[model samples]
Target: MQIDPSATSHPALPFEYDVCVDRLPDIVTRETESAVRSGAIPTFVSTDGKTWVSYVDLFINMGQGRRLRDPASAFFVSPEAMRRISYSSDQIDAAGPDLSERNKVTLAGAKRIAATLAQLRKDLPPWPYDLRVPWSEDFDFPLAAFIKAGQLDAYPSGRCWWVRSVEATKLLPIGESFDDPASPWFVGPHGRADHAEVVRLSAAHRRHWPEIYGPALTPRVR
Candidate 1:
């Protein structure tokens, strides 16, 4: 189904906040490594050669004060960990996989948004100075998933996938510190967020691409 443009002005209810984390255990890595040696992909690697395994734990505060323990809601594997299990091509291929028919539909909806963003970028200027670095790459799946689940909100426009308005009280604990190579939290400086800046830049994206964005706004989660 196509997204309606007029809905842009209609605001959804505020999102609730809670915390999230990465919960892969040591044993899982050992088992995974054994499998990798036996021909599986060894995506997990320690930054410092001495350490054989890498794991991460993050603190994510969903809008609500609660913290989650479920892997889906609280914990996420590091991209590096994921790489150990599969290749980038495979990961990209698995992006929108077979699932409940509803999920398939959701995936299609997301693809539409992705396409819109791709086109919008061609016409827009770089994100504002403060946001330029982090906004360089296209939005990632985790963030997109959060937006799809109504955990986050974005304003799209003819020019870009602008404005990312997250719940104020929420704090997402992205594991892997920038300083630690082995840590899953090591998203480069250009990968992190300056919340306020993202919001302001998103507004700019909206202003520029209003028309294309108009037909693309849909409920976060059907």
Candidate 2:
């Protein structure tokens, strides 16, 4: 979205539209217009511990959207399966002359992700979790499997990981110019009733599932 007209208030951050949309649950977006501000939510740390990246950026980059392949390729190996296979830099060098430099780098990065995921999985159970399921901080979500190796990183669920991104975190829908029903971001003042509506709508739109969009668009009568 064209630098949100509320730029003076929402001041932009370094993230892109899709990243912001994907990680909507992690951000606080329903505050008053004057209170809504832009910032980063540090979610993941680099394996080396020297740098960090937000969930949105990392999620999009690591086989989720735009930056990588679709989340359905054989690449997104399960965390359990990923943890099973050991990864090492030597594995790249030993790949021989046939392996291109780009592929070698990807392999090395995969090793890092595998290591990180292995460490994360230590605190959780060995079961496939759905990314589409409602997220809760109280529960340990399977982040490692969200997007792996350019795939939605699924088990038997067959759900997708890379959901659609939105143009804005919050839309006032206050004026005729700003209130366009055709726009997916359109949220009347009454929209405040359900803060998560934006995310639900975006995901449904991204998946092209009219069934979901239809129900979500039905106005709440509270």
* lDDT leader: 1
lDDT tens string, model 1, 1-222? 222223421111110101111224454434444544665321222233222321211111111111122355322343433212111111112233554443344334334433434443343333331111122255442334454466555544432233322331142355523335465323333333333323333453344334334455621210
lDDT of 2 by residue, 1-222 (tens): 112324222122221212222222222222211122233233322233322232322332232211112235322222221111212223334236777655454444333433333333332222232112222446422332333433333332233221211212222244422235565333332221122322343343223322222355432321
Cα displacement (angstroms), candidate 2, residue 176, comes to: 40
Looking at model 1, residue 107 earns an lDDT score of: 36
What are the RMSDs of all candidates, in order? 20.1, 20.5
Candidate models: Cα lDDT each: 0.31, 0.28
TM-score of each: 0.19, 0.21
Give the TM-score comparing model 2 with the true structure, all chains together.
Answer: 0.21
Off by over 4 Å in 1: 1-140, 157-187, 191-222
Q: Candidate 1 at 92: error in angstroms?
A: 54
